[model samples]
Target: MPKVTMNINGRARSTEVENRTLLSTALREKLHLTGTHIGCDTSQCGACVVHVNGKAVKSCAVFAVELDGATIDTIEGQAAPDGSLNVIQQAFKDHHGLQCGFCTPGMVMSAAALLKDNPKPNEAEIRDYLEGNICRCTGYQGIVNAIMAASGQAVPAIAAE
Candidate 1:
């Protein structure tokens, strides 16, 4: 077992995990951060997306040992210290971006990454940036609208929001 140390959700966390332990497993089982979902182990689904050193990476595809001493930001860290939802999260709720809520964490994380790199993404840009994430419900209209709204852009009228 390898000792993995990371700054998780703004706190220092260390855990001993097997070499084969996926980052998603270390997050969920060891660190007790359940917001990062594991929709598919094959990495086709972006359900396990998280910020590794400030970039979105599919946690399921990476081993915990590989990210030792990294800075990890999970969905749990998206809220304010006062527990208020962040802009992306609030927009998701306001725009009805989630249905079953399974993909929301990843969606929110990905949207955050997209907005960080491109603050004002158009509908097409948002759609293109979200190609890695899949939402089985809401047809992605609300999701797109949420991202747009979060970026302070005007969402199309057909959007759910």
Candidate 2:
């Protein structure tokens, strides 16, 4: 087993895992970060999306040992320190971007990452960028609206003190 060290949600963590262990498994099974869902074994579904080194990545496609010393952020890390919803989360709720809510976490994370790179994305850009994340419910309008709304709003900063 190979040992891996990662900063998850600003917390430094280390674990010895099998070489072939997927990041999703490491997050969910080992770290108990169930927010990163395993919707599909293949990388097609973006439910297991997580920020790796500040970029949104499909955790299922990455091996745990390969991410040693990387910074990872899951959906659970997106909320405000007081347990209040972040701007994106509030946008989703305000826009009704989620129906079943199974895909909302991934969608929110992906959108948040997208906004980090492109703060003012248009509708087409939002759709094009979010194509990787598949949502069975709420279609794409609500999600798009949520992202659009969140794009202009400032995200809540995580408290360090």
Candidate 3:
């Protein structure tokens, strides 16, 4: 077992984990930050996305030992210190970006990363950037709208149901 030390959600954490332990496992089992879901172990699904050193990475694909001394941010950390939802989160809620909620954590994480790098991504850019994240519900219209609104861009009108 390797002793890994890292800053998680702005707090210093040290834990002993097997060298083969995935970052997702360390986050969920060890740290109990279950917001970072594990939809698939093969990395095809982006449900395990998290920010490592400020860049989004699939936690299921990374070992805990590889993240020693790194700064990791999970979905649980995306909210304000006072427990209010962040802009991206609020946008998702306002625009009905989630359904079933299984993939919301990853979607939100990816959207946050995209916004950080490109605050005003166009529709094509948003689709391209979020192609890795799959939402089985809502057909992604609400998700795209949420990202647009979060970036301060006008959300295109959605058709009436």
TM-score versus the correct structure, for each prediction: 0.96, 0.92, 0.96
lDDT value, candidate 2, whole model: 0.87
Better of 1 and 3 by lDDT: 1
lDDT of 1 by residue, 1-161 (tens): 78989999889999999999999999999989999999978887798899999999999999999998999999999999999999999999998899899999999999999999999988888989888898877459999999999999887888433
Q: How do all the candidates rank in terms of TM-score, highest first?
A: 1, 3, 2
State the lDDT of candidate 2 residue by residue for 7-96, as single tens digits: 999999998899999999999998889988888779887988999999999999999999999999999999978999999999999877
lDDT against the true structure, each candidate: 0.92, 0.87, 0.91
Q: CA shift at 14, candidate 1, in angstroms?
A: 0.1
TM-score of 3: 0.96
Point out the worst 10-residue segment of candidate 2 by lDDT: 152-161
Measured over all alpha carbons after superposition, the RMSD of each candidate to the real structure, in angstroms, is 1.7, 6.9, 1.8
Clashes of each: 0, 0, 0
Which residue pairs show collisions in model 2?
A: none
Off by over 4 Å in 2: 153-161
Better of 1 and 2 by TM-score: 1
- Model 2 residue 125 CA deviation (Å) reads 0.3
